[model samples]
Target: MSENTINAVTRRHWVLIACMLSMFMAAIEVTIVATAMPTIITELGGFSQFGWVFSIYLLTQAVTVPIYGRLADMWGRKRVFFIGAGLFLLGSILCGFASSMGWLILFRAFQGLGAGAIMPLTSTIIADVYPPKERAGVQGWLSSVWGVAAIVGPLTGAWLVQHFNWALVFWVNVPIGIISMLLLVRFFPESREKTDRRINFTGSCWLMLTVTALLTALLQAESLGYWTLVLSAVALLAGWGLLRHERYSGEPLFPLAIWRTRTLLAGNVGNLLIGAAMMGISAFLPTWIQGVSGGTPLQAGSALAMMSIGWPLASTLSGRLMQHTSYRFTAQLGSLLLIAGTAMLLILHRESPVWYAGLSAFVIGTGMGMTSTTFLIAVQNTAQFEIRGICTASVMFSRMLGSALGTALMGAVLNYNLMLRLPQYSDPVQQVMSPAGREQLKPANLDLMLTEIAHSLHWVFVVSLIIAFGSLLMSRLVPVQKPH
Candidate 1:
C-alpha cells in the first residue's frame, strides 16, 4: 500500500482533479437536465412525465449511497467507483438514444445509481489520500465542485441544445467519466486484502425498500395524497424489517452500533437538519423571487447563485479554520451562521430587493459549507480506516435524506397555505412559476395569490429557521475530535 501511495504517477493533485471531474459530472446532472428538458419535451413530447426524469435519478442515487459505501469499504474505493462510473457512463449513452420519456427516466435512474458511488467516494478517497490537517482544505476544494457544476451546467446544456442536439447533452458525461476513470486506474492502485464477501444482501434490499418508499411518499405528499399514505406504511414496515434483520445478521450493512457514538450521532443529526434548512431555502427562495419579488428567472437564478459563491468560499476557508480551532468550534460557528442566515431570510418580503435575497442565500451557503466540511473531516478522523468509507457515506446519506425530508415538509407547508388562501384555484404554485399562466388569472386574483405566496414563503422561512437552530443544537453534541 505504501509503495503505491508513493508512486510518482498518482500525485495528490491529479487524483483530486479526477475526483472533481467525476463529481462534477454527477453534480451537474440535475441542472443540465433542467436546461435541456424543454428541448427534450419538444422532441420527445413527454411533458406530463417530465418530473419523473429528475426524480427517479435522484431517488436511485440516494438509495444506493449506503450500498456503495459499504461495497467501497469491503472491496475498495477504486473498485466500487469503477463499477459506478461505468454504469453512469453507460446510462448517459443510453439516455442519448432514448426515444420516450419513460426510457429516459429509466436510463437516468441508472445514471443516478452510479452517481451514488461517485459522490460519496470522492470524500472517502480524499480522506484516504490526505491527513486531518490537509483533509479539510482539500475537501473544501472538493465541495466547490458542486458550485462549479451549478454555474457550468446550465450554460453547457443550453449550448448543446442550441448548436448541437439535446441528445448530446446526455453524452457529454461519457468523455469526462472515461477520463476520470482512467486517472483513477492509473493513479489509484489499491492492494486491498480480500475480506469475507458474504454481505447481508437481504438487509441491503430491505434498506433500499425503506428509503425508496419514504422518499416517494415525501415527494408525492401533495400530489398523491392517498398513495403517499400507502407508501408511508410500506416504508415503515420495511424500516422495521430492516432493523429486525440487522440485529440478527452476522454482518449488518448498517453498522448500527457505530451510530451510538456521540461523534457520529451529533454530526449526522446536525448534518441532517442543515440539509433540511438548505433545501427549504434552495427550493423556495427562488419561488419568492420570481413569483413574489417580481424578478426575472435570470434574476432569481442569480439570487440563488449567491450560495454557490458563499459555499466554495467558505469551504476553502474551513480547512484553515480547523487547523487553528477545534472541529467542534468550527462546526459550532457554522451552525450559528446557519441560524443567522435563516433569520435573515425571515425579513425578505415582496418589497425586499433581490440583493437582500442573495445576501441571505450567501449566508446560508457559507454556514452549510463550514458546518458540513468540519463534520465530514471530524467523522472521518474518528472512524477506523476500515469503516471510513461507510462513515463518509453516512454524512452524504444524512444530507440527502435531510434534503428529501425538507423539500417535502416545506412543500407541504407552502401548499397548505396556497390551498387555504386560494380555495377556488388549483395548483397556484404552477401558475406562480409561469408568466403566461399568471396572465391567465384575473388581475385581482393574481394580486391576492401573489400576496399569499409571499406570506406562505415567510412561513417556509420560519420552518427553515427552526431547523437551523436544531442543527446548531446538534452540533453541540459532537465529541472532541481524536486524531486517527
Candidate 2:
C-alpha cells in the first residue's frame, strides 16, 4: 500500500477508536454504577439521596443535548466535542473524590453536562465523515457500544469495588476519556465554518428546567408523594413556555421546521416509543424473571443480554437492507419483530424456562436494533447539514425522554399491582424482597412473600407487553424513504 493510503487508513482507525472509547465512557456509566450503588450508599450513608447519583446525570444530559446539538451546528464539531470530553473527565475526577452522595450527584451532573455533547456529537461527527449510504453501517457498529457496555460494565464495577474502592468506578473513566479527547485533538479535523452566532440562552434555560422537572417527577413518582404532582405541573408549564419561546426566538434552540416533515415526525414518534418500551423492559425484566420465574440472577442477566445481542446483529443487518430496500420496510420489520417478542412475553408463566425469556428478549432486541438504526439514518437523510445536528439531537433527546417516562410508568404499575393484590403483606413483602432486606424476612412468611412478589411481577410484564405493542403501532406511521 502507498504511504498516503496507509496514513488515511490509520487516521480512520484512530477516529473510530476515539469514537468507541468516548461512546463507551458515556454509555458504560449508565449501568456500571448499578453494581456500586449499594457500596456507595454504605460508605456515604445518604440512602434517600442515592437515586440522585443516577437521576441527575440523566436529567442533565437530556436537557442539555439539544443545546449542544445546536451549538455543534453553529461552532463546528471539534470544539464542542472537546469541551464535552473535558467536562466528562473533570466530572469523573471529582466524582472519585466526592465525600458524600450529594457531592457525587453534583459531580455526576457535571459529567452529564459533558455527556450531553458526547452522544449526539459522536453520531454527528460520524455523519460528517462518512457518505450517506455508509452511515447506516457505521452507526450499526456504534450502536454496539451500548451492548458491550451493558455486558461488561457491571462486572467491571463489581471487580473494582471488590479489589479497591467504589470510587474507582468513577475514576476509571478519567484515563479513557483523556485518551479519547487527545485522539480527537491530534487526529480529528473539521472545517471552520461561519454561521449564526446568536444563542437563545432563555430558551435553553427553559429547556433545562422543563426536562429536569419532568424527568425528576417521573423518576420519583412512586416516592415523591405530593411533590410529584407539583413537579409534573411545573414541567407542563415550563414545556409550554419553552415551546412558545422556541417558536418565537430569533435563533431557536430546536428548529420548529424539523418537526414539520412527515419523515421526521413519524421517526421521532417511533423512536420515542422504541426507547420507552426498551427502557421499560431493561429496568423490569430482571425483576420479573427472578421474582416471578424462579430464575437465578445469572439467568435474569442472560435474558437481558439476549436483547443486547439481538440489537447489534439486527443493527448491522439493517444497513445492508437499507442498501436495497426502503427505510419504512426495515423499520416496520423491526417493529413487528418487537411486537412478536412482546407477544412472547405475554405468554410467559412461572414454569417457563429461563431460555424462554432470553429468546423473547433476543427477538425484541433485534427489532429495536433495526428500528432505531433505520430511524436515525432516515432522519439524517431527511435534513440538510445546517439543521442536521439539531435533528439528530432531537431524536436522541426523545428517546431518552421516553425511556425516563417509561421506566417510571412501569415502576408505578409494578408497585401498584403489588400493593393492590397483596395489601395485607405489601409493606413487609417489599422490604424483604430488597437486597438488604432479604435476611430480615420472617422465616415462616418467606415462601408466601416470594409467591406474592412473583404474582405482582407477572402483572408488571403484562403492562410492559401492552407498552411494547404501542411501539409497533407507531412504527407503521414512519414513512419509507428510498435509498439514495
Candidate 3:
C-alpha cells in the first residue's frame, strides 16, 4: 500500500479531528435528550406532545440525509458541512429558548435537518481523506464516538439538569459545533470536482414525503389504528413516484447507480437487517433482564455497556483484517458472530446468570462493528468520489429505516404475545411490562406477569435471531473482492 493511502497526512489528521467533534456532537444529541425528557415535559406542560420532540428529530434527520448528501456532492463538502453545523447550532440555541413542547419539537426538527448532513458527510470526508484499508480504522474511531456518547450523554444531561436549566443541554452543542465548523473551514480543503448537476427539487419533495408518511404511520400505528394503513399506502405511492422520477430525471436525487451495484445492494440490505436486530436488543433487553432474571437496572445497563466495548474493538480490528483479507470475508465473519450471539439469547432463562446476557451482548456488538465498518468502507470504495456522499447516506438511511421497522414489528409481536397469554387482563398486562407497572401489580401476580412477559420476550429474540441470519445471508451475496 502507498504511504499516502495507508497513513493519514498531518492535514488529514486535523480533518479527522473536526469530523470527530462533529460526530460527537450529533451522537450526544441522540441520547442526551432522553435523560431530560421528563423534566422538559414537566416544565413545558404538553404531556401529549412530548414524544414529538424525539420523533420529529429522527424523522427529519432520516428524511433529509440523502438530500444533504447529494447536495454535498454537487456543491462541495466544505460548504455543506458549514451549512449543517450552522443550522444545528442555530436549532440548538432555539431549543434552549423553547417555552413549550411544540416549540421544542419544531426546533428539534430543524436541528435534525442539520444532523442529516453531519453524519453522512463525516464518513464521506473520511473516505475522501483515507484509503480503503485505513478507512476501516478511522471509521472505528467514528463508531467509538457514538459509544462514548451513549455512555456520557445521559450523565451529562443529568448533570446539566441538576446543576443548571435543562436548556443547557441544547446550549452545550453550540460551542462544540462552532469549533468544528471553524476547524473544517480552516483546515479541510475541498478537492473534488464539483458536479454541475441540476437540483432535483421534485424528486427531493417526493422522497421526503414518502419517508415522512412511512415514518409517521409506523410511529403512530397504535394511536392511529386503521389510519396507519392509509398513510402506509400514501408512503408506498409517493415512494414509487420518487423512484420513477429518479429513473428519468437528468440529475436524480437518488442515483440509479445505487440500484446497479451488487455489492452495495447486498451490503445495504445487511445493514438494514442488522439495524433492526440492534433496535430489538436496545428496546427490549432491559425489560428481559429486570423482569425475567430479576437483575437490577445497573446490571441491565452493564450488558449494553459490554456491547459498546465490543463494537469499537471489533471495528478497529476489522480495519486490520481488511489489509489481509477481502471485505466480504471480514463482514461474513461479523455476520456469523452476530448469529452466534443472538442464538445464545434463545437459551436464556430466568435462571440464566447476568454474565450470560453480557457475553451475548458483547459478541453481537463485535459483529455489528465488523459488519458496519466493512460495509461503509466497501461501499464508498465502490463509488466514485463525486457520488460517494450519496452512497454513504444511503447506507445510513437504510440503517435508520431498519431500526424503525424493526422496533415496530418487534413491538407488535411483544404486544400480541402478551395479549394471547393474558386475554383476561389485557390492559394491565402491557403496562406491567414496565418497571413501574410491575410495581403496581399485586405481589402474588408479579411472578406470573413476569413469566408471561419473559415468554413474549423470547419471541422477540427469535425475531432478532431470524433477522441476524438474514443479514448473514445478505452478506454472502456481497462481492467478496473489492471492486476496482
- How do the residues 303-328 of candidate 1 rate in per-residue lDDT, one tens digit apiece? 89889778878888888887877787
User: For model 3, how big is the CA root-mean-square deviation?
Assistant: 2.7
Q: Which candidate wins on TM-score? A: 1
Cα lDDT of model 3 by residue, 168-250, tens digit: 99999988888887887777776446345767899999999999999998877887899999999999999999988988888
Give the TM-score of each candidate.
Answer: 0.95, 0.91, 0.94
Residue-level lDDT for 233 in candidate 2: 98
Worst 10 residues of 3 by lDDT: 1-10
Better of 1 and 2 by lDDT: 1
lDDT of 2: 0.81
Which sections of candidate 3 miss by over 4 Å? 1-10, 427-444, 482-484
> After best superposition, candidate 1 residue 64: deviation in angstroms?
0.8
Of the two candidates 1 and 3, the one with more favorable lDDT, higher being better, is 1
